[model samples]
Target: MRERFDVVPLAALFLGAASFLMPFAALKENRVVDGLLLNGFQLAGPLYGTVAVLTAFGVLTGVFLMKNGSRRRLLYAAAGVVCFWLTAALLVRAGMMLTGGAAPRVSPAIGFWGLPAASYVLIDHSKKGRWRMWILLVVMLLPAALLLAGGRGEAISVFREWSARKGRFFDELIVHIRLFGMAVISAAVLGIPLGILASRDKRIGEPVTAFVDAVQTIPSMALFGLLMAPLAALSRTFPLLRAMGIRGIGAAPALIALTLYALLPIVRNTVAGLASVPLSAIDAGLGLGMSQRQLFYRVEWPMALPHVLTGLRTASVQAVGNTAVAALIGAGGLGIMIFQGLGQAAPDLILLGVIPLILIAVAVDRSWGFMIRRWVSPGLDMKGLSA
Candidate 1:
């Protein structure tokens, strides 16, 4: 057997070198003005700059030196995360050194993003791990938390934007979560039964699934646009809906659009889950004189739970990202910040909004998965059932 060289660490090293060769940080005079592009050496000075270089280099060289795969993985994960955190810190430090520790409009440049993204990918193992993935998130985020708590991050461009809009941030974040949450929950409630029905009855299933799948075909913005007219009419005709804030350009339309978008993955997965249930198990349930409802509740549904959760997980993550577009219609989420940032030509404001949006998606993806793995019976998994 040939020894397989680890490409992960090499990729990390390539990204790190790119960080050194290209601009590591962009320096701006103000939030909306362009300035200079600073390399790692230019931004962090000798000590921190040298450390960054050595850290990045050590990740690849050290990993190759170790023949043991476990040791190589451990080294790369540790070094990669450190490089990522350190790159962020360097951006913060650069701001301080240049602007007397007050707010500085310094953002991570293209080169800076490559390394951290590579590092993040390095530790983000299987999406299935109960704790491993969460632990990686914590490890990755701790530096940001500490910098913010200790106030060192205040000078960084992204934090400066946050400080300016702290109140609006929370308000918009709540709306974003609400839109995403309601959409996914609504999808699950409506999708699961339809999925089950489709599995149990071909007549009802084919067209229903076809429609749900068709919903996904429409561009999200176009779907949102299509809903606007009916929603606007409803609000005008129904005083109660108007009183309840069911407007065409706000949460009501946004929520409906997001829910429609969320249904397909869920319905597809639910159908798949139920379809995948064993004939033997169904026969056993029938042998005990169990009716269809009893079999579904007691045997089929329970056995298909992991797959259901998988669908829910998929829908939830999609909803979180899709909810961002809701901001365009005044539905409001972190997307507002992103759009505002773009309108104002302020990169930091965009980062403040975009980062949290990514985090929310990651949180939904991880937490739901963690719950599925931790609570769902090991035997209930599709793979287990097939075996």
Candidate 2:
């Protein structure tokens, strides 16, 4: 039987071409049209037309080389094109930044795969056992470099100017950090206990599971509103609680809302992980003269660690993204930029916020995923379980 060709690369190529052309057709002013086209070329120039054409040719050649076998060579060719484009884009961006050139017009197509390809290539090229450590070091150092190189100062100044009516950038950062921290901690505390209780008692499991499931049915914004009045009451009753007050608004309400949103996945995952432990393992532990505590701590918990970690990873990513909605309240976050941009009709500023939030979530998910795969699930290859 003849092998079928992979269509993904072809699709990506067509999509990229269309992305370049769409903006060209939309603009009316001659100078703006010319400028957009020029920008598109500069943006696409990193992966020159020649490179794309050659990559397509290489894919065709590989098909013949393999005699139409099931093996995948197109992935490599496509990856190569992506890497070349990304490297070029990064260098172009660096040059533009240094020389005070016109800002690179954003292309969603180019933006989507560029950095990811570059990062993947860098990691793939690094020596074994040290790749992750090096990646972390780069991540930590890049912001510092950008800061000292002027991006940080410029960002701070812009944010300060925009939020002058609100507060300092540091203040906004603190509020977001606190809200995120509270949501995470609260979810863990609530979820873990419920998970343990559910695992211990069959009667407790059904309703708790149902409740968490129902929580998911509630829209997040609606939940925020629902919690506002109760939280406000709690805040009013105790003067000491005033500092932690929800006020039916701001970070406190946002935190409560996010915590509620985060609870279900962690709780459900934890319950599933704990309950999935083999009965034979429990029997063996008991037969080995282990106490209940020992059986739980030494056997069951270790088996469940991967699952628990999986839940944490999921909850963390979800919290990071969902926290953006906290901007609807007074809790300031990167989402503030997104909302402000929407209000001002500036898509670039919206992307500025959204892009970083996505980067943060990806970074957290990948880092935690690596740790879970390498350490928590070492014996059984439970990386799939994390997924």
Candidate 3:
């Protein structure tokens, strides 16, 4: 069966070559020499036609190379790629029409559509080991090629223009980073100590946990307002702690608010993780002549790390989103863009802020989740780890 199937690639090659040549032949028949003369070597027509041919050839190649059981899978993937490109092309056409078809460059939808298909083909073909590196190399390089070919000067220019807004950009970024950092650090410093105390004594644990749970019950915006006065007062005493040199009403209040909100998850997770350590394990460590410090470092902490990391991940993502609310308090970040857009009724500007915030939250969550699943979690390998 493998020997019979080996002819498939050869057949695919012939079919692909025929499909490519046939399109050019059809184009040539339209006004023949005059059409060729008008296009100055018929460049643009052939370029577009070539992309269409290559796209089809990729699908055919993928079909021929896949095993019978996997052929359906490959076909589905090819269809998906084609659908993606078609939808993107349609959207681009729509956008062009909306803008009176006078945009400086091709629609971004083309790159968005084409790159994935090319990457899929490169990755699929490279699996045989012989061409794997070359396939990946092309996949990596194809974006730059497409970018150059598509003449993304306007896109680059827009970004360059935005880059000139460095003050607002950095101001927003720095404010958010500081707020998030303060939230995480304050939660860790305060929560870890409370976690240890709670683990040591139920009397302290119950009341503290109840208070944190109560705080958690409060809506975030309400809590932000509730804490602002107290935090604003504290900021008066600590001149160096103010964010952006705006003393009373900026990131200081936001940071304190986020920190208070972050504490419950961290402390609760820490307490639970520590408490989950078996009593027998602790007794065994003691019986083996382990010191209190030794037991905690060697056994308890290692066992608890996965849960702690989980809490941290949760807190980080929460802090990221919550920082947007801080914008209401003049703690400027991407939220500034969101509010600016809202005021101006510009969805694009709103997206500029909201999209990056979502991306940052997701990226941080995934990366930290991977770290915990891979290294921190006990008795699990990569294949079994939850995403």
Q: By TM-score, who's the top model here?
A: 1
**Which pairs of residues collide in candidate 1?**
none
Model 3 alpha-carbon miss at residue 8, Å: 28
Pitting candidate 2 against candidate 3, the one with the higher lDDT is 2
- Candidate 3 — worst ten consecutive residues by lDDT sum? 31-40
TM-score of each: 0.90, 0.73, 0.64
Worst 10 residues of 2 by lDDT: 24-33
Evaluated with lDDT, which candidate comes out highest?
1
List the RMSD of every prediction in angstroms: 3.1, 6.3, 10.3
lDDT of 3 by residue, 99-194 (tens): 222222222211232334443443343333334445544544464445433423222212332444657866787777778878989999998889
- Which of 1 and 3 is ahead in lDDT? 1
lDDT per residue as tens, model 2, 165-284: 345444555566667768988999999889989989989988998888898899888888887888778888877778754476877788877888788888988898888799999999
lDDT of 1 by residue, 322-366 (tens): 999999888999999999889988777888889999989878886
Rank list by TM-score: 1, 2, 3
In model 2, the runs with Cα more than 4 Å from the true position are 1-12, 15-48, 59-174, 381-384
Ranking by lDDT: 1, 2, 3
